[model samples]
Target: MQTTFENPRYPFKHHSDLNQGTAVHHPVVIVGAGPTGLAMGLDLAMQGIPSVILDDNNTVSVGSRAICFAKRTLEILNRYRCVSPMLEKGVTWKKGKVFFQQDLVYEFDLLPEKKHKLPAFINLQQYYLEQYLVEFIDTQQQVDLRWLNRVTEVTPGVKGNRLKVETPEGSYVLTCDYMLVADGANSPIRKQLGLESRGQVFKDRFLIADVLMQAEFPTERWFWFDPPFHPNQSALLHRQADDVWRIDLQLGWDADPQREVLEANIRPRLEAMLGEDVDFQLEWASVYTFQCRKLDSFIHDRVIFLGDAAHQVSPFGARGANGAIQSVDNLGWKLASVLKQQGPTTLLKTYDIERQMAADENILNSTRATDFITPKNKISRVFRDATLQLAKDYEFARTLVNSGRLSTPARYLDSPLNTLDDEEAFDGGVAPGSAALDAPIIIGDKTSWLIDILGTRFTLLIAIDKTDISRVGESLPELLQSVGVDLVPIFLFSESTDLEVPKGAMCICDPWGYVAQRYQLEPGTCYLFRPDQVVAGRWREFTSDSLISAVNRALGFDMEVMP
Candidate 1:
């Protein structure tokens, strides 16, 4: 299996528990071996939580499925040092162009900011993503990945969830304190539990054709609506790793999905898009209809659902896998803290609450984007065409244009975990309950990104000036501990030169004032960041008592409404 980014088959190995009559117990067991499940295991491994990942197949996904991974997803994966292989193999890009009737109407840069380590998005085949996750998980002894281990039945329980896994040898009983259901859209686990994902399935089909070709096209996303190449349909062109181009052609509900994927039928379409003289090989093709749906609750006792198993969305925004990864990022720490008794079990409820909100937001956006892409009636199509036409000229109309509202991390603005800003007037910064933004920073002499410094811990980011840093950096940690709160103090300085860490505290040098500019910070500004890199609270004036209350509220310890 020592090859490039291709479909790699894994050898199934027999485990000693196969013949054991009694159920082998584990603290955590993930139901699917897809990208999110593997990542969940890796995240738990980073938290010193061992997990088992069971997959029905022994190979990376057959076709190129989620080809786009957003910056947020990359940052999460980079936490465990597994994103290097993906960044190296994936096609990195930021700009994307939207076309209407063969003319470019608008273009966008997903990440227009500088100083961030990761790109806006990378186009790597889904199989390669899974392969990279599995490869990384192989190195970690905490993750026990069993290929060809299919869960035949799931029995949810109060203490543990019982799963009957059928492997190559025989069936075995397995029990886990927590069961993460990451199985895909058609999740059998979700079905076995008599739960269903509720939402709208658009009445349209899309053909995914991964073609091997040598083309002069730049590495930008090209999406067209009613282009001359396909007459009345939408089409998309993207570059993946290894010269494999991902082409998505929209087919109305009446088209025969089975027949449209044939090489004979797809060749003419490609020739029309690319010139008739274009030489290409069809690597893979599949027809799919997207839906925006999710369960009523992600948490069902000891069994929790993650990714597609809990919710599903149209792939238009690349939110399917990206959202799943973000959920894992949110859950890994909360679950670990609960299992380790660092936080109350009620903290797990926040993951259910927060991720459901994200699922709803993604569904709402995806539903709207789908409606814009495929207008059901002629009147709707007229409005769509008019908007597209106007977008070519007017800036205001460009705002109305909805090709797809590209994926970004969900802002949990109203989350219960947030500590609302009190009477202190604040300008702009990472809002409480929203994910933290990255900026340029330096440590000692070597320059580093802000995200790399915000490790998976409760961070107390103190925006300190040169005058107060020496005193604050040395005393802040002990002061917080005396207040019965533990926080990893990261001092942000506005000076370019390296500062002496006499107390061996974490220091960030914001030479160019990027941190202050990005966070809208003053000398005394302080921000509390959760282990998931989410801002739980921030204050204009720092205080140990206030921070302790905020920390308790963030951990679901204090239910009182206090800012």
Candidate 2:
């Protein structure tokens, strides 16, 4: 359990490194036990994998940075069973208000429908999110968290990866099968890799103050643009759970100075917003700039980039934490498959394509939100203000601006993981990720369908209707396993629906189970999804011998078994 031992190869072994010396070997070594790193470690632990989470910070940031939670992120947290506490400690906002020049401009309510049995959005501080995750990680015996252990350098070794880390006790080396770098925008690991960050950096800086106000502010988020009080400044007042307000002021590029802008200007703006003499104890305040940048690739040999280390979105649409979680979810399963030796090595390349596209889309969303706030030129400013004002009269225009489609999960369309033909192709429709694909059908049950049927291995979903269950069950499992395959058979029970009789069909259902893949009651038809959720291979009217051959092809194995 003690991770300190002397290793001469450590790059930082001169001064502070002498105090600490440990040697550690882990399946996955993660840097920065922040929200992104903790989420990755939690997921890997759930899959029975061991992970070491190391962070240089002595403690989690007490100030609120990212507060809004998207629908996708909530769904992920639910899987780890951490959503309940998060929802309890966080403020849930169903409505938002936007204003201009001290007048009501537009207001909109979040999606009220229970689309996926989760709320639309929740606003909680980033620190609480990390704390809840740390608690959950402590409960898992397989997850190990090491605070104040800073990852100094990462070198891609011939066989695996070599990581140099420094702790209060001393310094040591951590060799791992894979390294996840999540050390934020100024990531030293990324710098060591020499990966260049590409994007535009706006000159404007905003002052953010997290304070508890005596007077009441509406729970809904309120935004102002060029108000009469401060015509040159745009302000945002976000209502937190503990009667706290996170206020952001758009200070001009050439402000007096950073501290002056905060203590002298930001405090007064908050006092004015309250509209009366009120005591506001400022907890934390600082000036931060926005940048729209992304890395060229997320994968570089044994090391993969994650969170702000991979890309940065301006804090407009609140997409940073949500996007980072998605990146981890995308990479988690692929890493598992590669380590388990069940999938091809090339599947790892798809992580870059899928996550980069998602990050690029987030950049666009943040850029658009930034433009709407501080338009580039006079012409754009006029257009943006007019649109916000017109939103009061027109419902359609307001909905367009409020959709937040950029926060949605990135689809795996062009990746080799997708095997849909013209008929089964995604017609601009959302497809479940590998984890959600072929999830068990939970009809009239409170539990998720996939929870019961999906073992910790490959499975086959069979929608059997009057088919021979005994012959299919006994022969298929043995036949598949003989050819280096692990298949679990699942049956779909639907009495009234009309289904054609196909020999082998894999039933695919929507997340809500409206309708999707269907096949007849024939016993020989088969459909397969890779561990990562992409359809690997499909077959119809095949014998036991022939089906084994198909499974082998999907696994990219040439070994022939005595079927």
Candidate 3:
């Protein structure tokens, strides 16, 4: 299939004919339109940034790869104003169940003793999630999504980057200010960039099938090890929205082929759990091995890799897409700040620092999950099964057993981006809530603190007396506006008692609230926060000169913006 282009302009300016290479220019070019790319697009679009999203596939994938959605991801989507419809369709799970030798041994509820604006987890089909995001992107005036276009070659240009993309029509060249590579596990962009990735690919394979069942399996997730149906294998089942159940079977590495496994392998296990008479239709099925790895660097010159392009993790805890979207949430605001020139381009380096920490956390959790499911050898397997069985009787053991190392925002206390003075001032320490990073704090009268404000802009939690506001009010707003910085200033009173309130701390909440800068209230003191929400500079012992300098440093301003 060959096509011709006489001449194209603007977005396709660098395009050549299918056979002849022409050049097209786009401010931002993304390689894949999976959750990460679509998310990055939404983040940029919210800031009114123009970008182009391209995917190799012509249509959305029918296979349900990632079915579990985390609380953190739902929060990021809420920022773009798309979560309403999705929450309507997603199934919320309040608890999870674990079994050993057909005995119900462990049960844990995510909402046991806490209050939160969002549920801990929701089960939604990946296809529908993608549909919602893609639709949202289509509605954005700043976005152009091109499907069925595959990149055959990417050449780093002198100033920017050049990409040769192949399509059903033909091949064209695309020059971009930055290339956000959200392409999946077998990312060609990561390979083309020559970034080294090292990890272990397990020899074992698992058969996964999504089925619609009529039987009454509780909404909670269920898993069985060494069941009568398949004595040596592991069977895990999860209930999804609309009575759909995602089932996975550990089939060792060299188990039966796909056809035989689908036709003859799964019924026995299904019968063991749902009774022999239960009926269900298979939605999708596949066999694949789990992998763990990370890229040597997320940023290589003008191209920044995201999602699976940067790292690959097992599907054990549904970390792949969820973690990737979190990475997007972390990088989006920083990129926007750099583009607007409100912050130094050097601030872009912090994207690597912060997101790389996130990647490391994901890798650790993912590896722990992978090891828990697939032990290395016979001795490891025995130890895992014995520990799980022993956990049935002891409370301490059960906590460790059911915990699964789940997922949480990585702590950024040790980063150089953090202000040393804030750490000393916080009686609670430099981390967000000081609750061992278990759950994010909720603001007073606000339905959300973690998800709603995240992935949008920088936030300033101003702790000041109402009487003294006039002093800071004169120059604070003007300084923020001059730097093109989006600032959210929240006022806290001295006598406020809300635990969720930021307290005597004047803090900065970035798109992701992993770290908040704290300052003990001084009558006139104010702090400037970077787009990443780390403190760029502080105005403690406040003076007009000192405050202006902090603002300058926060915005990376060499010279003050003249009034």
Candidate 4:
């Protein structure tokens, strides 16, 4: 059966010149309506900040690009209430397999822990994710999404940024207090500002093809090194939604990129892998080279670069889109707070520091994966083959196999925002500046995930016995509020207790002790979380003055308080 292709409608109705003769000023202007731009706009809107998103194109992504969505990215999407559609439409998988010449070498499970709400990864076409985000943006009154609007020029001024945007009808001038340049790797804005991303570009080329076929293959990542069909090359196969299978074939530097993408050349390769009798239709194909590069700093005065505009990584680990969404998650709350005057602009500086650290980590991992996959010389090839052969027998050798390291959230251990644990000595607990892990909790006959309750603002989480709730609830809120910090206190109690909760704070039962095990809970332990759901500080026992000092430090006010 042949697969049918239905292109999404791209309406070019929102022309900026339509509102001519009026000088328009926006608080925040986001260039490009890709995942990063759309996510940032929606997150800012959720925080009561208005933004205008401009995109030269009027449609979602063209191909099934960036199909792997990590768990952290899903959590960020859940915060916008747009994850349901993705979960419904996406194919969830946690297991992956590796093969050496048609022989199964080893397999791995990404998230062995069943306690979390979301799986380790989901395979959804990028177009579907972008479509869902655009729909969510439509419901948000604070977001003004204008398609077919291209940014031609950007000038940073003392007051704000002066922008020249071109639409199909005409061009118009606009101003914004802050600008987000998410225009992608070949960012015109980055070039306009004379900025360059410094890093290495690998020589190997890869052919990515999306094939629509009905196959009995399980929904797991299948990777083959030196397969019988494609000799001395690596091939990856992954299942996506709507019977679409993403296949990536490694074509060395000498392979003609143009000839490799042709249907005549690609069909034989598909026939050799999946039998010649199997009926399939070509959905999309692209030939590209891998590069690992990133800007020295994501922030440029009033202009902030995000997503592909700041960082670029090889597609092996599925880090590009996942990392970009994380960048949006980190910047959204801080930018909103700074714009609202609730926090100093220095808070935005932390975004550059944190994300640059994340970018560097990604580049390092990607570079390692590239080197292992495509060995430059004979010695490297021998080592790679030896590791693969040994991985089939020894468990320790499996660790050395680098199909891809996979994307994990970057823990900001050295961030300035973290209030270090000076007095406490707990192992494997939720530390300051780390992303908070979720556990299952019970709330009034409803089973809920911990992350559903603790997002969007600064929160004080107290893990205490049911008997101590009233005592802590009586004074903590008032004490924290007096220091200009309005905190929402969440009380977590053990499952055995059935006690009346205090009036000021919300209560939940940690049913399976997952919270206790994960958070390293102790009596009188409390945690302070930032708006982006990263831990700001924690204390085994804290006085009012100590808590106030920690709060000030978390908001970058300690520098201001210094003599």
Model 4 lDDT at residue 341 = 81
lDDT of 1 by residue, 235-338 (tens): 99999998999999998998899899898998898899998898888889989997999999999999999999999999888999999999999999889888
lDDT at 340 for candidate 4? 78
* Model 2 residue 257 CA deviation in Å: 5.3
Better of 1 and 3 by lDDT: 1
- Candidate 4 lDDT over 1-563, as tens digits, reads 23334547768775554687765788999999989999999889888899999999988878888999999999888889999999999999999999998799998999998789888999999999999999988899999899898999889875689899888888888889999999998999999999999999999899999999999999999999999989999999999999999999999998899999899999999998899999999888989899999998888888999999999999999999999999998998888878878778888888898898899999989999999999999999999999999999999999989988899988888888788886446676988878889899998788999888776777878888756766766776578557675467787888746676555667888879998889888877888888778888888874676677777777777664322
Candidate 1, residue 108: lDDT: 83
Native-structure RMSD, model 1: 2.4
Residue-by-residue lDDT tens digits, candidate 2, 289-352? 8799988988888888899999998877778999998787777766776677866666667678
Model 1, position 470: C-alpha lDDT score = 60
Prediction 4 TM-score vs. true: 0.96
Minimum summed lDDT over a 10-residue window in model 1 is located at: 1-10
lDDT of 1: 0.87
Give the candidates in order of TM-score, highest first. 4, 1, 3, 2
Superposed by TM-score, candidate 2 places the C-alpha of residue 415 at a distance from the truth, in angstroms, of: 2.0
Q: CA RMSD for every model?
A: 2.4, 7.5, 7.4, 2.1
